[model samples]
Target chain A: MTSPLEQKKIRITGPSVVTANRTWDGAVVYRTAKQGWSTELADSAIVSTSDDARALLAEATADDVGAVGPYIAPVELKDGGKVKPGNLREHIRAKGVTIDLQVPA
Target chain B: MYAYDELDRTLINERVSEFRDQVKRRLSGELTEDEFKILRLQNGVYLQLHAYMFRVAIPYGTLSSKQLRRLAHVARRYDRGYGHFTTRQNIQFNWIKLAELPDALADLAEVGIHAMQTSGNNMRNVTSDQWAGVAPGEIEDPRIWSEIIRQHTTLHPEFSFLPRKFKIAITAAEHDRAAIKIHDIGLRLHKNADGETGFEVLVGGGLGRTPFIAKTIKPFVSGRDILSYIEAILRVYNQYGRRDNIYKARIKILVHELGIEKFAKEVDEEWKAMGDVGLTLDHTAIEEVRSRFSYPAYEKLPHMPDELKQAAHDKLFERWRKNSVSAHKVQGYSIVTLSLKPVGGPPGDASAEQMDAVADLADKYSFGEIRVGHEQNLALPHVAKRDLPVLFKALDRLGLATPNVNLVTDIIACPGLDYCSLANARSIPIAQELTRRFANHDTADLIGRLHINISGCINACGHHHVGHIGILGVEKNGEEFYQITIGGRADENAQLGTLIGPAVPYAEVADVIEDIVEAYLALRDRPEELFVDTVKRLGVEPIRERVYATR
Candidate 1:
């Protein structure tokens, strides 16, 4: 069976952003409009078309100093410059564990 | 229960300092990510989907109360308030920060626990039967030999960077509770006709993308020469094991490529070449290792305790006792398994408060020692029979007394897509839904001794291949699907489960299991026959027909 990440053969749908894991801490980071990585999706550079998404991913991959495994992920923009992940996995990666962390202070 | 000596302490302390320097280099941009990845993995750190995960090995699954308390402290201080006890008898902290990992290792070192060889292509944590010393069997304690192997294999220069990760399991009992047949190297210690204790070495058994039951390479190797034999096997594997393909680099592949006879011949030749080396265990050193295991001051009481007899009449206590309690070698003692599979909760997960409570319970009742079973449950290996009621009450209050050992609700599942980056589906939710479906104690009791193991992918971390009812998660067109297998057994008569039919959707997994169990209920000759036995008698035809027919 093909991997879920490799099964995407359809046309690029709506807005998307190039995201990867920060190399040092493995935190999820997104490529920003200024060619830098940001932890917040709202600060990311949103690409409306497939060509721009591909270019943004190429740029992220070339500047791999800060992150690894860069890939284009779907995102939804909200009012007040907010953004949320378009898939359950990316959402989990952006936030934290799905279950209760329950860490005592 | 084995306390670290000066050499052990020095090795661990030095490794921690070295790792601290390596982490510093990585952060300072002096080391590449590729270089840092190997360094981090060597110390049991992995970069998962969310954050870094650190796995700490509980050698032979034995932990002192002090050690377990220290783990709880680490979980609360460095990570989230809980730790996930794994199927390999290790505990993993999933939310570990990369920067604080050195400090966490330092704390673990203070308690004689290090994350050495928990990952990487070297030898992983050595696992053994949870009831190694106390189980009702006439054999030597396997932990002693496991510790010997651990000491020998830790950072061994020749075997440090094997082609792939190697796992070894030692079981002294005849029942094979440790799932020895599914390990890379399985050592079963037994006595021969002349009453000489030795190990029957089995090699190449593994459950991954390709599953194979281990084959006996050596009929018997003397207890003294077991290390030499293992060294021979590793030497051969290190030389000829596949290194080109990561997927086929495990020793099992090599064993498969070269038949068992040829593999045995190569290992025997290597063993013969290393004649009378220092690898042969000295009796004095063996005795020293054996002396470290602390034995409780067991009192000579009657075979049956009065409290237990009284509790036997109570239905609730009787049910709990029937499921959670096991016969111990000692007359007045019992092996009490604390179920980590609470209803609607993740399997093998314990909160910090629960850890502290269990540690206290161990100190109060079972000689301050706890054992983590490969089944993902904690066992009080030497609990007095008279303290059953109070212990059960304490466990009940902590939500640890689920009374579902080997039952349908006692599910073994891997940290699939929920935590693992390699997973194709989510195993925890499937396990949770199944446990909820079988929440009724009466129903669970009716379906006795049904081991349901779920793995998110073919990696088989959940030992799904050996489960009586195995569930493997797959992906098709971005949707999660589950493949069901039936009649697998992981005991003395071990056999891999057969895949029933086409993969079912995630939504239909629990119902498919229900269908299989319902068919077993209808087709069984009697309730005395187990699910595996019934499948063996009637074959998978009935279950397969029923499962697919319903769908």
Candidate 2:
């Protein structure tokens, strides 16, 4: 039987940032598509099993649909960031943003 | 002993408050069970079979009198007036309520102790030679490195979510008292060819379902980069370790699957990437930590006390020498191992009063220091040879003078199904029965150096796989039965034991073991042939024949 963690896949998509230090996949400091603004994790993060991602995206569907970003696997956060399995949603929520997610990945 | 500086104290205090909030959140249903489980586990709280079990760290197995007294107080006030010393050199209090855990953490912090990182998939308590500073063969104290590693790994942001639990051990002694070879990371410190102090770093060694003696990744890693080198190894594991299966999550599995050579290559790559800039031990920082663990002042004393010599010539002293005594670094002093494996009792248990008494002895006899061994015994590392009789008398009063150190009766048995939620069967009763059967010390010692370890589950916290005669308690038809394994050991030469034959009814385990010992006596090349060697030379056939021939 697959564990709760194993059965789900997470995909995160957001604006890209290019710097020597911020090039890593799990690096938390990155640029937003909205120009001249940088987003770094200070309070909360987001983790999505495909199911959690799907539910989150469904909730955000009525909002600016295009604002629903791509999905990045939560496990990728181990590269060094405040994002973890337990507090991912809270992290994104704390950043005044909602996550766009997909299911059955 | 690693003295807690302002930072250590501050970190533990902050952890207490953090865990207190977590506990409140859990209790008020603000957190889900899954969320609370990880949170509590990270704080060293476990929901065991009968009740909650809290594992309190004794960093590098060194504890102060004040800390020990606090443990006694916690046991009396919060637990069942007893605590069990664990093989990892930590103390575990059983029967803690989920509500009372926060209070217990608060109590522990009041005396410079906390249970942080004792559980969870993070680096553990960082064990070392219990007699680190005082052991005779030790070139330098291992606790200094252990403390460094401890501080480096505590709530380490990079390592909090490992594939599985990680254990690291260090030994400065040639005899390998800390069992360094069977840990996730083992460090054997030695002076290099250039007269510089360095370490032989071993990686991917562990004991469990798959017991592997660590293979040398670096013949000698310079002492300065120990932290960075370790970080590199963990990075390699974190990126590539198999987390698909819980059983295969340990780095040992990754080492085996990748093969040692390939694993070494990955570690080297990671090491190169994580350079020495932020990770290497600076001389000032190393000195600051090393100063806390500097050698205790030794006043010159006589070469062998007359009283001790007289007692040594007597029967009781001879027995104690065969059992309680260990090699000492000081001429007139000795390292005394206080055996907790008394006949027909729990292997690592001491009552609250007994804990207080051991604390008192540590204060009066051993320069206010106590070392808890991985074998579940306590050590007074600086006992004067002259004080053996008095010490023996005091220990005897506390029922700790069992004279079965490393003998058959001095078994290593886990809390088993009785207290552990993971156990399939009870281990304590089997241990008790074996002790009763081998009640005679002479008989027990005759089967010398017999390390009998029993674990109720495969987690092997009892180190059953390394025992000379290992027994595993398994559940069959909802009843407890024990299966015997032979030739296991956990020292400089560590080997996983092999199963002898079929499982035995719990009631007959002691008799079966006696039969096995009798077989060893009958087929021995000589008395000097230890149990491990004899078993290795002749396999498990003789013991099997003797055990099952009649029944």
Candidate 3:
């Protein structure tokens, strides 16, 4: 099991054009988990291929979601999205990648 | 007190005008709240729970009588006829209107004071040992460097919007009265092997939610390279510090994540780039700034005043000695700490009238010098012993002669729920009630020096974690509850207090504290055993048993 710090770091990018206000660069990125993206904002989340991200992005629509807009696509793990809530190891086993949803440092 | 030169006076006056325009713009809706927040905060204005709070900087804890008089006038005209001194050597007026801030700044500027850089994510007001020039133990005056750093950082455009707010403290005394270890940057002025004075720099210390004692990044940085070294550390933090999470944005988290070795290496790398450029100590500038803080004329006199000698044998003078007098570097002169902790009164509070009286006392008896301590107390750093009787008589009439500067009743408490929007519980009333309960000055003196810090929330504005007897206020079912921590201190030897079992109700806090003190008295080896040593040897078990046993 990879330590949270050892997880592959990826930059989240390009949701800014769709954002209501100024879009940040390399703004949204997540790390790949064995299972699914970790719910913790600090944890690394999995990002699937752009096609999968596009499809998930289409299916998601919520009023609260609209204001913040275009939540990052769910990383479709080879296995499934099911995983323990906070257990990073189990999260990796279920979801291939976890979404790192925050502004870039 | 350091006198402001023409340039200093002009800059402050210009800053007041610039801020007045900004305030006008903000009130006119030309600037939105998001835009105005940073601007207002830079001027030390905060939109708090019930009203706006204006935090004015008392630079390096030093104030002239003119400045204090100006503060009193501001308090009377703009605020609620009182001012609250803070643990950071600043003053906060809780009832100022947003529109009145411009006028307040103007008033402060007229006397060479302003609220610039007291807040915001930039460098804050530089703090030093309150006993800077007068302490016999000091290697050199710390106020010189404090003033230097104050001028260097004030309105430094490039560093304004760093990852988070930064604080710096300098101490020349070995005892560390400035709480240097718990600042963002702590500088201990030390003499090298060759007897050359320089600094021992520490980085990443703070006392907010995630308390950390800064590490020594450089054991010794030459006094000349101080600015370059600080620039390096700040630049590294600015470039690599986490902006993603506000909680982890402090330089401490960066030092924690990357490790201090790596952080220090990065700072070293940056420091090399600015070598011999932008920082060469500009000899003339150093002299220019240093001249403002030059030593005052010292007069030779007998060590003991006959009147004070006769009075010390008196009951009243003995009580005052227990609480008020501290040793001064000059013979026949003493440092007098005037306690604001009157029973049932707010800690750090001074009414406009009281402030005027203090200013009067400073002008008349103490060379117009006043210093504010980090523990929310005020000091007259230079007082002739011969004037003690007259000063004491005047103070006694004003009710400023509490004589419990560092006693159990000298509680350091936050504004808490009464004023602060962030408080989880009420703090002032608890402090007031406790001070009332422990009303005996003699009893407090008997207990010896013990710090009691109370905070409304985990933000630790009152520095509860460092109190010898720390009380943390929490809310339960819309009522106030307090959790006690024992043995915490932020002296030369810093330690985080340990939790003592279950939390207590607000009303029972004073009794619980009494029980804890009584337990210490019983378990201690001798009267020489102060609160910290007693708690250290016996551990919390004895006090825990005594406190909860009553249940």
Sort order, lDDT high to low: 1, 3, 2
Best by lDDT: 1
Q: Write the per-residue lDDT of candidate 2 for residues B1-551, one digit (tens) a residue.
A: 66678887898899988988887776565665566678888988876533568999998899887888899989888887888899999999876766777788889998889998999999999999888988887878888888889989998988999999999999988888788888999999998989888899998888777888889999899888999999989999999988899899999999999999999999998889776558888899888999887455666768777877778766876797768888788888889998888776877887888888899998888887788999999988888778888888788788878899988888888987656656766687788778888989888877887889999867788888888888887767546688889898888787788898899977778888888888888888999899889999998887788778888
How high is the CA lDDT of each candidate model? Answer: 0.89, 0.76, 0.77
Model 1 lDDT tens row, B1-551: 78778999999999999999998887777777777888899999987777788999999999999989999999889887889999999999988877789999999999899999999999999999999889987498899999999999999988789999999999999799888889999999998889989999999999999999999998889999999999999999999999999889999999999999999999999999989888877789899999987788889977888998888877888889989999999999999999999888888888888899899999999999999998889999989999999899888888888888999999999988888877888798899899999999999999888999999899999989999999999888767899999999888888999999999998899999999999999999999899999999999998899889856
Off by over 4 Å in 3: A1-105
**TM-score of each candidate structure, all chains considered together:** 0.95, 0.83, 0.83
Off by over 4 Å in 2: A1-105
Better of 1 and 2 by DockQ: 1
Docking class of 2: incorrect
For model 2 chain B, the run of ten residues with the poorest summed lDDT = B26-35
Q: Candidate 3's residue-wise lDDT over B414-441, tens digit each?
A: 9876666467666787888788878887
Give model 2's DockQ, 2 decimals: 0.01
Candidate 1 C-alpha lDDT tens digits along A1-105 = 233344354346888888877876677889999999999878899998988988898899776557766788888877875888876667777876566443221
Q: Model 1 misses residue B152 by how many Å? A: 0.3
Question: Over 4 Å off in model 1, which ranges?
Answer: A1-15, A48-65, A76-86, A95-105
